[model samples]
Target: RHQGFFRLDPHVDPISDGGNVFILGFCSPTVMSLTPVGGAMGSLMNQRAVSTKSWAAKEDIDVLMEPRTLCHLHGDARQLLNHGIRMGVDAAQLKKQGVNVPDNASLYDWWGGMTSPVQRSPMRLSVVLAFADVDEIF
Candidate 1:
């Protein structure tokens, strides 16, 4: 599974920001499914699996730095914070632009289609959405 996050306006209440963040992540891959079809009426029945890594609060992410399962960091807190926040924002923006979807079908059918692909591809299992406002499990 792929993981990601976003940095919201701290001014937004924590719960509301967190909820929107979660929706933003959940709605992301849904929007991706809207892709391949150009938002038409097809489905991603042909694709494979879809999985996402969990969301982590800024503090939690900081703690993960000790082991650093994710590579490519320069070991700077401000940089990491900036990167994570931007990732969340970019995930949101990507949804707006249309990317990372299996097909252009309804959410249920799209999910159903993803659950059962015509030709299984390990690549599909790697697909995931990320955002900062997102909460754990989103």
Candidate 2:
């Protein structure tokens, strides 16, 4: 079991284990209990490329996954993309901070029964394991 929020800054994980990281979300009926209410909702992925000596996000590759899902990143996807959790900000809050939000923008209009602002979740329990792929090691 893990405690507190999981707001990670986007970057390539150290991968010192020479293995991929696996994430599982345990959020369910209490999903709304996420810190910031709707903030920290899901996970985000962005394409990354080398810019001289540093890596930077390339445009047009943004993606977000809803809460309590399973995902694995391997090979190029693991090494060449920056990943992190999404931070949710209420339109009201944004307005209070002087950012413009259309008064009519209610936002949560998913077609089906699912609704979440992309890759986001406030907290989760993570178990890390390492194993060198035999093919990669051989």
Candidate 3:
């Protein structure tokens, strides 16, 4: 479980790790956005060179990850793109903007889908699993 605002900058796995990473959303239904900056070209500098082209052509490639969603990042997607959750304002600000910030009971129902509500906290959890090749490690 994790809480608070964060932005993971664009990066590739230095250890290689089979050039793959998986993220499974467990709770909270907020949208996760991914932007593919460019095709993997071995280094960040090379990736940036093509970023303009990628951004111009990125309209159809942006992804919105939903709750219970499983996302796979590999190859160029893993090495040349950036993904992050939107940082929402405080509850009061949200309410002022006409967003219904869920109360504990509502949040409990939203997460658990149970008639009996349980205490809820501002926690969002996602499990990340990375895989690597044995030969690469050895």
Number of backbone collisions per candidate, in order?
A: 12, 9, 0
Candidate 1 segments exceeding 4 Å error: 1-84, 87-95, 102-138
lDDT of 1 by residue, 14-66 (tens): 33222222112221221121111112111222121122111222222311111
Q: What is candidate 2's TM-score against the reference?
A: 0.47
Q: Model 3 Cα displacement at 17 (Å)?
A: 2.6
Instruction: Give Cα distance to truth, residue 33, candidate 2, Å.
Output: 21
User: In candidate 1, how many Å is residue 105 off?
Assistant: 15
Report the CA-based lDDT of candidate 2 relative to the real structure.
0.37
Q: The CA-based lDDT of model 1 is what?
A: 0.23
In model 2, which residue pairs have backbone atoms overlapping below 3 Å?
41-120, 41-121, 42-119, 42-120, 42-121, 43-119, 43-120, 64-119, 65-119
Model 3 lDDT per residue over 1-138, tens place = 445332233344453567678878655544344555553322333333232232223331434345677889876677666654333334443344455655322222111111222222356677878886565578
> Each prediction's Cα lDDT score?
0.23, 0.37, 0.45
> TM-scores across all candidates?
0.16, 0.47, 0.49
